[model samples]
Target: MDAVGLSLMNEAVGGSEKCVSAVREAFGAAEALMIRNVSQVAKDFRCCQTPKDHQDQVELMQSLADIVMGTVQYNEESVLMSISDLCGVMTNQSAAYNEEREPYQRLVKLSQIYRSSSEEPCLDVSHEKRVKDLMDTTVQSERRAERQWTYQTCTEFGFYQTCEDASCPFSGMVTLRSQTEICLELFGISQNSLPGRVAFTNRYYGGDEPHAHRVLYVNGGVDPWKELSVGNRTDGGEEAESVFIRDSAHCADMSRGRVTDRRSLKNARQEIEKHVESWLKTAQQEKKRTE
Candidate 1:
């Protein structure tokens, strides 16, 4: 999910204050499920310790780990959808406000000041133009400022780290007040605006990949880069490198396919955590071997 969408979900699930708890809950739930799956895989693999069986088990475990990672990606998408729904409601309300009889009369009066002052004296014109420009700039700045503020505020309230991006954080109640405060400060439109709240929401989600650093595969593949290329040089100065390239079709034969339901997702998460743990162990062993 984009930062904004994540924030909005944080809001919808439990208001801005409880956003942190909600996110933690979601993450924790997924983790627990993943752990369970890993345990089951381990139990099944433990019965077969023959060298050939061990090799098959290792491949199966890695595939299970991939499914867990996929679940994390899917959960992020689910959270984004929930946030989008909340944003839709806010947009409808804002549209209705524009059609209201006495909607923000103060801002309307301010607009008239610009419209009527167009033909005033050159000095007066220049001064008014300058003032208007300042106001416009201020409004834009404030809107941008507010977006930053709201993102931080949501983070502060929810206890989620503010996303590195200035526009939105990973979690919190992303409200219209927060959105408008950002827009007015940045863009200068108080009532009618292009793209509107949805635009803001899109910005929140669209920038998610860069923010999350989630891996993307070129094809429906798993661990295509699993085999690290380790180079060695002979005494004669000839170079050699070991590269293990798995057949993609053969790898697919090992996969369980994309699992999405909660049970499967939970299992996937566990499998991933197990694989990560195993990877860490292997890495440490390799380091020791090198040492």
Candidate 2:
């Protein structure tokens, strides 16, 4: 998520001074490693291939780099681990592999890194013992949830975050086409079908303009997902409330109340609590009426 990266870079807000310093330090170290891995991959990939082949390799490298940087929940240790994995995978290549197998090998290693780092396992890996160790042997409790979310992406949500914008910290290689390739490979969902599916989802839910009652919508100003949420009620029909937590990260207010939490997040949680209290009182009154 571009917004996640931006939030990490915001020295003035989002996190406490110590947390922010640690994040920046970890991110900087990881970024340097990732860039080196990219450069090495690029150098190896420069063997006179066809134009299409070159483009494909370039895109693949970019997609892998994006994964290293685009993890939604950024923990300092996790960032360091991801970059370490990238560096390990890139440098662990054997001389036995021919040029043709290089890309496939890289794909497997990158997929392993992604799965080990994220909630959902993306590409399946069947490679070296080192790589196999990266994936947990035991099945995750969230397997079903991850699969359901993947299915949603294929059939409805299509919430693919690509680094296409010029200001994005990741390489521009992460295009819409590159992002959707997984849908085709994993779920047989074609890229052509995604736009329609996403449209249907937005239409069905009213795309942040839903006709609902007593609903409280909350979003963090620095979270990119906020763009898809109800910022303001346009129809002026339903009295839906939306609270924007300025200078906060995703779900910052939902976390346990911390001394390090910004003032905006604390206030947002108070506002949410007020709404919940009001709703409880209204429900009690309705029950009394029915009785």
Q: Judged by TM-score, which candidate is best?
A: 2
lDDT of 2 by residue, 175-278 (tens): 77766765676577898989899998889988867857788788876666786678865354334778887666567677788786667778889988988898
| Each model's Cα RMSD | 27.0, 10.3
Task: Return the lDDT, model 2, position 174.
Answer: 57
Q: Residue 6 of model 2: what lDDT? A: 56
Segments of candidate 1 deviating more than 4 angstroms = 1-149, 152-180, 183-262
Instruction: Write the residue-wise lDDT of candidate 1 on 1-291 in tens digits.
Output: 233233333432322423323333333332343345534433322312222332233333322222222222232233222322323322334644354222122112222333343452211112222223434434555345535554443332222222233333221222333333433444454524434544564467542222222122121112212221121212222121112222121123224545432343344445445555765786799899999
lDDT of 1 at 70: 28
What are the TM-scores, per candidate, against the unseen true structure? 0.19, 0.61
Best by lDDT: 2
Clashes of each: 16, 0
Clashing pairs in 2: none
Off by over 4 Å in 2: 14-145, 234-238
